[model samples]
Target chain A: MKISARNQIKGTIKSVTKGQTTSHIQLEVNGTIITASITNEAVDDLNLKPGQNAYAVIKASDVMIAVD
Target chain B: MKISARNQIKGTIKSVTKGQTTSHIQLEVNGTIITASITNEAVDDLNLKPGQNAYAVIKASDVMIAVD
Candidate 1:
């Protein structure tokens, strides 16, 4: 979905696992692991899994980038 | 905190608002909204807001990317 905000990155979906009630989706973007939780139905529709490439679409008002 | 995962995006913290119990931090990366919920304490420590660049560190098992 085209959410209102700014900060979209192309990410590779690494894996999709089942959470308690929400499904946990892991994305690999620039060698970083980006995790998001969605509904079970969403998981079924996406048909996600490991090795599958996807995007970690983030929609928040606060984005924090930490450096080493 | 350095999380064990891959998919870290360098985003700018657009805004930091108060949620029920957790603090909602909005992040802007490439014109997308990447939101994350942190504890109130974390929010206080970070002292985040708009224009502040941060990283939307996602650590999930499933990442989905949709196209038009």
Candidate 2:
């Protein structure tokens, strides 16, 4: 599906750790690792597995800038 | 406010472009620019301006991993 999220980092799936209702999908982009927490239902629907290519989709609004 | 978001990237405000309803806040993080789309009210509430130190806060669940 087409999305409006601006950040789409291409990476390879390193691992998938499932919890009760959510899952953490680790993606290795270049040498950096980005962790994505999604619903277990989405994980099953996507059929995501290790060594697969994927993109980390992040919406611009979801990104909040804070001053320390 | 203390949030549960996983990714909190520290950066400097590079620019702020406001539209009718939302504003795009650009942050320079280690030479990379991360854009955040927020409401104009929020911008005013936060008083975010250029050349200020800030952080790009991102929730883990909001990050979606996509496959081709």
Candidate 3:
């Protein structure tokens, strides 16, 4: 399905750390690790595993800007 | 204030569109416009304006992953 999020970078699953209600998925993209925190149920539904390719989907609205 | 978000990219405020409850903040980072949906209260608190330097903060939990 198509999403409205502007940022969608391709990466491979580096690791998956499951917590009580959430899971932290480490995605390795060009030597950089982008961490994504998703629900444990979503992780199970996606059947995400290490060495699998995935896309990091981030909504523009979710992004916040800070000033120093 | 210190935040837990890992992704905090420096940028400049390109524009600020305020709505009734929410506001759309456009931050220009390296020629790319990163849109942020924040509350109108935040805009007022931060006093965000155009051409001002800022940062785009994104939490890992807010990030999602998709597979092809």
Docking class of 1: acceptable
Show the colliding residue pairs in model 3.
A64-B57, A65-B55, A66-B55
Give the Cα lDDT of each candidate.
Answer: 0.63, 0.87, 0.87
List candidate 1 segments past 4 Å from native: A1-68, B62-68
Residue-by-residue lDDT tens digits, candidate 3, A1-68? 88888777688999999999999998987666778999999999999999999988889888877777
Q: Which ranges of candidate 3 are over 4 A from the true structure?
A: A6-12, A28-33, A50-52, B29-32
lDDT of 2 by residue, A1-68 (tens): 67777777688999999999989998886666778999999899989999999998888988988876
lDDT of 3 by residue, B1-68 (tens): 89889677677999999899999998876666778899999899989999999988889988899999
**Cα RMSD, each candidate:** 6.0, 2.8, 3.2
Alpha carbon deviation, residue A19, candidate 1 (Å): 19
Worst 10 residues of 1 chain B by lDDT: B59-68
Candidate No. with top TM-score: 2
lDDT per residue as tens, model 1, A1-68:
56653435566778777866787776676665677777877777877777776655544333334533
**What would the per-residue lDDT of candidate 1 be over residues B1-68, giving only the tens digit for each residue?**
67764456787778777876777777776665677767777777766667887776644333334422
**Which residue pairs come into collision in candidate 2?**
none
Worst 10 residues of 3 chain B by lDDT: B26-35
- TM-score for predicted model 2 compared with the true structure: 0.75
The TM-score obtained for chain B by all candidates, in the order given, is 0.76, 0.89, 0.87
